[model samples]
Target: MKKLVFIFLTLISTNLLAQRPQTEQGKGSLAFWENLTKLCGKSFEGEMINASENDQFYGKKLVMHVRTCEDGKITIPFHVGDDHSRTWVLTMEEGDVIKLKHDHRHEDGTEDRVTQYGGTSSNTGMSKVQFFPADQETTSLIPYAATNIWWITLDDTTFSYNLRRINNDSSINVKFDLTKEVDTPPTPWGWED
Candidate 1:
């Protein structure tokens, strides 16, 4: 009777443990990223506006090219003062997060004047990067709260980018409205459909 009771208790404990919820090992489940596969292969045109009053920077026009293959790429041609321009390479990461890297050189190998334009996704659902000007001290580019961080959303004929910036006081929000060309769709990759 003692051995049988012990066996029954062991079976009950095992059953309960199996029924318990299993914790995810990686970044959340795919349900958190529903229909995210549609974001790939979309070409977009947008703008990166600087709404910070403390800084003298203003708004700039930007064009983004997002390609989805095995290794996806997002190229943003950012327009600065006058003819100054740069291209930012936004790459996807683990669990669909993005990392933006800067390239101020043109195709002819000329240097453009785009400053402080590289960042990675923060844990707070925002992309955070540091700004170190020649004169001012280094600081993080804080978009207003979690809303200012922008991502690319696209459909067959329409593409939109919603960019938000959190202010220093954490009370104000700055936003930019961007639109893209509707006629042209990106050429499908050799491997992509």
Candidate 2:
């Protein structure tokens, strides 16, 4: 009877373990997701650190609102100056991967022509950072962005959103101060009040 009970316990434990992510990358990705989720409903102010003078984001007021957090998805609205046209949607996928999509919309809440372009993390990134290479959909939507690589890094003090174009060697790096929570921005374009 003792042997039977021991075997049953072992089987249950093994099965439970099997259901969890087994790879380092998978575990790290999950940790990253949890870290980001902690900031839901908060807002932060950002500055463009590496943009050229002619860049649209240069000297503009940048804000990011961690507006929504659900079971498997988080939506963040990125407001640039008076433009509420961009939102970042992070969706947790199977195998501990995260998909990052850029949701762009007009003032009237209509989808933009080049919308929903982003990528998925190819491997389990660090708990504080994740890299996303342009996915097929991104390239299809914007051919010039085929070599784009976007990455986000989050730490206790700051959260950074970055983009690098491999072909042109151009990059955009914007850092948001996380230590201070700012006023929540207005609802992003295309989102219901």
Candidate 3:
């Protein structure tokens, strides 16, 4: 019975430790998430850093609101001109991995047919930048985009979103000036203002 009790205590302690935030890695990743959370309640205008004439967002009122932030997740609504349907969701995954998802919704709070496509990454990057590769859900949704890699770089001066479609030689980079806070735009589809 004493052996059984010791085993039970060991299991409980191990699980408790796992649930606690202790190591530097945990601190670093949480710091990265906090860097983004700090932008909450603010809106910034973004422009495609690299654009061709055919780019739709090139001359539009492109905005991103680091609108909603919580302890382990943040929801940023990205607006293009008058389209309020795209929201970027970032969640703290197990330990240090961060999950990225694009939540597309209709005006009536219905999920778009093509939505929630992203992945998680344990990117050993600095607290300012993290990369997420296409996950299984993304591939199942968009087979051709299986190699899509999305990365966000956040700093005191800028917050940029970069995407590369591997094997397709296509990339998109949009950078927002953190120094310029814009007027808040309309609430995103499926979200309360």
Could you say which candidate leads in TM-score? 2
- Candidate 1 regions exceeding 4 Å error are 1-37, 45-63, 67-73, 76-84, 93-97, 107-109, 113-116, 124-193
> lDDT: which candidate is best?
2
**In candidate 3, what are the lDDT values of residues 21-93, reduced to their tens digit?**
4323446556678688888899999999778778777788889999889878899999999989999999987
Write one digit per residue (lDDT tens) for candidate 1, span 65-144: 34332445545444333332445455565655555555566434555444335455542131112111111111233222
Q: What is the TM-score ranking, best to worst?
A: 2, 3, 1
User: How many clashes (backbone N, Cα, C below 3 Å) per candidate?
Assistant: 4, 1, 0
Off by over 4 Å in 3: 1-27
Worst 10 residues of 3 by lDDT: 21-30
Model 2 residue 92 CA deviation (Å) reads 0.4
lDDT of 1 at 154: 31
Model 2, 112-141: lDDT tens digits are 999999999998788889999999999998
Error of 1 at 35 (Å): 5.8
Please report how far candidate 1 places residue 108 from its true position, in Å.
Answer: 2.7
